[model samples]
Target: MIRAADIQDGRLRGDEPRRIDPRVHEANRRSRLETGDVVVVLVGRVGEAALVEAEFHHWNASRTVAVIRTREPDEAAWLNLWLGSPAVRAWCERQATASTLQRTLSVTALRKLPVPIPPAGLRAHLLRAMRLLEEKAATNARITECAMQLSDAHFAREASDGTPWPERPLASLVHITAGTAPRPRPDHDGAMSEPGTAFVAPADILQSTSPHLYATERRLPRGKEGRVCAPGSLLVASREDGVRAVMNHVPAAIGRNVLALEPESVSDAHWLLHELRSRSAEMAATAQGSAGRELSRKAFAATAVSWPPQEVREQFARLAGRLRERARIAENESERLRELRGRLLDGFLSGTFPKGPLPDDQGVQPEGGLALSGPQGIS
Candidate 1:
């Protein structure tokens, strides 16, 4: 079943979705997904949506997901893109009813969402551009995944080779510093690029696919620079799901829920990242609670970890660093593509881009010749 947690970074994570029996699937026929259906999260991370591609067809969604079917198949992509806009996202946040634990978006709010349609030609142009950029980003993600897998393989081989790596307390090899709580600021919401240090939060770490992070959901004010961790520091967070870690590529202020692990040497940082990732489940056991899990500093610090000699670690670091750098480059390129996408969408919606013929690559004529109709509302 596709739960709210399955909707991640504007895409559906089908890796480990819960499955239901055939009887259950047939009973809840309305939840069955058809190709081109858009599933939006109605609980946590409200409004996050993903298009139901051919592979996911016939899959049943969980109660937390709202299935949105466009009148026309082609409209599905356009509607999905519209739902990702800042205005729509903010609207979802405002409309969501907050409970003691989390916020929920009712079907009434989802049905009332305003979807502004651009001119026919402009809409066609925007869809083509969005597809091209999204495709590239997807390709980059694959490249990064492969690179990370290769690095993992290398670590496995090195750790298992003849010599026995000593079991040492985590605190002995690295300094574990807790993050500072963020001060209230009503001005900023959503991802911000304002002048300040990138604030690393649990969401940022959880959503990332790459081992390195260059930006985050929020930023810290200037004078708060002292709270920022060095560029190579590994940021860690724990939840009921598991433990996740990402090395910061830039100096970043760590949120209260995050823990910053700084190794004395750069080479050690590389080894530490993979070590922690490999032990995610093991480390998660040390977390304090079942709900809203928090890693126990005392437990975590006291935990024993594999500690290889300096020479062996440095050797592995050199090889792993090369692979990671390739992934980093792809991630950087993807970031640029995303920025360009936002600009293109903004320009087309604002009528900044003339309703003229676009470059061949950017323009894919829509199947229907009809001009885009009035504002659309979801059901």
Candidate 2:
């Protein structure tokens, strides 16, 4: 039999049958699930289903609803596909009881749901396609992991000493510049539409992996020469919040809270970026002001930073470039696959596609896994 506890442990990850807890389970202490069982959510946004792939035993369920066990085991995957379809999702949405906290589905409502049974061959093809997508996702995850490892190795090698390297004042290495917002005027339309410029505010600079500028409503076409940021220039946020924000990857027109740094002698933009990220917390803490924290250009220019040799800096940059490229590729692929999955679900459940019949036998039993509880607060 299926049990609510099995679903809680993620045993129904893919095409697996699931057992949801029944109110009667509380008193009997007996599992309510069986092999090839499917758990259908009744309350709180219905139409979510889980197929039971392995046998397990447990009790208890709160917001969850009814359990369905098919006579055939092989048909579980096809059932899962049907359940995840947009048509089914829409049906569930209609049945949901709207409340202030959430939408709920009742167990009785789930049993009467209708599903179309598709041709076996078509169902098999869809399952194969899903498997391929899963494989691609796994591959993308591996690529991202490798890229992270490469970055870690490079950084570890450069910062081995646990202390700042022999260095120079930041002012000596680069020219620091700032940008301004034009005073708001009555006649001037607030929309910025002209080309050849992108404006970046302190909010844009914060939480970016590389320097980037998104389009803004305000623009200054005439003041294009105020602060030009090229690919290798280091852009930092000058506001107290800017000190903690990292530049997203892209050239942006500077906002009032940002500072643009153009390297004077050697090309060590990557090194500088890394150093700034490492020091951001400290810098933000030391920022001066009562109402809003601000980082003065003069104070920042006066700070000293230890620099590694030119060769080391260049090597790190090259390695980082390769890793970042791979990361970008993986990220793009992941997004595409996710979109594909969504579309596939839409087609599969709408009765537009067919699926195979259920199997005659049950699947294997699962091993005991780790237990996860509710969130814990820090002491």
Candidate 3:
């Protein structure tokens, strides 16, 4: 089933959604999603929306997600675009009923959402402009996905190669530092802002589409830059789903739920990252708690980890680091494309766009062209 976390970054995450037997719900069932349906989060993180594509045509959504069946594909697409705007998100937040646990958006409030209807021609033009930016962003996402897949493949091949590698306890090779929660922000507004160290929570790691993180949804206050992991340090955390890890490109304040894994030798950063990534399932199996959501430091430290020869480690790092760097470049480009897309949408909806035909694909390119050439090594 699609959960609030599944709809992120204006799109439905590709991770498999929970499914039910075909006998329980058919394609014609009201609960089943249609191709053009728009799914909106009804509980926490209200207003987060995603368009149901052909891949999930007959899939079922949980009660936490509300399905809006539009008259046609265009209408559904239009609604999805509008729902992502800042104004609509703020309006959703305002309409939602607050509780000590979480906020809930009632169906009545969703029905009252203000929708603007423009002429067919104008709507088509707006959609075309938005579609162009979206396609570019999707392409960038694929580029990063390919780069990461290649890196993982390389590591897998090297690890399985008939080379002897000693297995050692994780604590012997890395210094484990447990993260502490930062002091609550004085403003009391739980929104992400700039000019502070990136505060990483477990959700940040689980929700990230890429293995590298440049920012997070929360930031520590100026004086509260608690336990920080260096740029290349491996930040790991676990939940019921399993263990998740990411390399922070900037100095990040770690949340109590996160654990920063700093390698004893600086050069082992990439090697350690890939090693942990490849064995995420194994490490997750050692996690404590009934739901496997809690990873004990003592247990994690005692876990057995493979230790390859220096030359082998260097070889893997050299190859994997280059692939990771390429992935970072693609991810950065995708981020810029999202920003540009948001600006375009904001302008179009606010009537600030130019009074002529929308810009062509050629005119929408950011300062640098959207293409890459040489591969670079990760620092």
Instruction: Highest TM-score: give the candidate number.
Output: 3
lDDT of 3 by residue, 50-111 (tens): 89888876677766677788666777787888788877787887788766445678766777
Clashing pairs in 3: 1-18
lDDT (10s digit) by residue, model 2, range 65-127 = 455555455466666666666566677676666553335666555555665555555556668
The lDDT values for all models are: 0.76, 0.55, 0.73
Could you tally the backbone clashes for each prediction? 1, 28, 1
* Higher-TM-score candidate of 1 and 3: 3
Model 2 has an lDDT value of: 0.55
For residues 1-379, what per-residue lDDT tens digits would candidate 1 score against the true structure? 7777778766887875667788887777777888888888887678888888888888888777888877765577788887777667788877887664456888777777766654455567678878889999999888988999999999988878878778999899888988775732424343334688877767678767777887765677788656678899999988776788888989887766688899988889999999888888778877776554576777878889878999988998998889988988888898788678767767766657546665443433332221222112122
Error of 3 at 64 (Å): 3.0
TM-score of each: 0.82, 0.47, 0.84
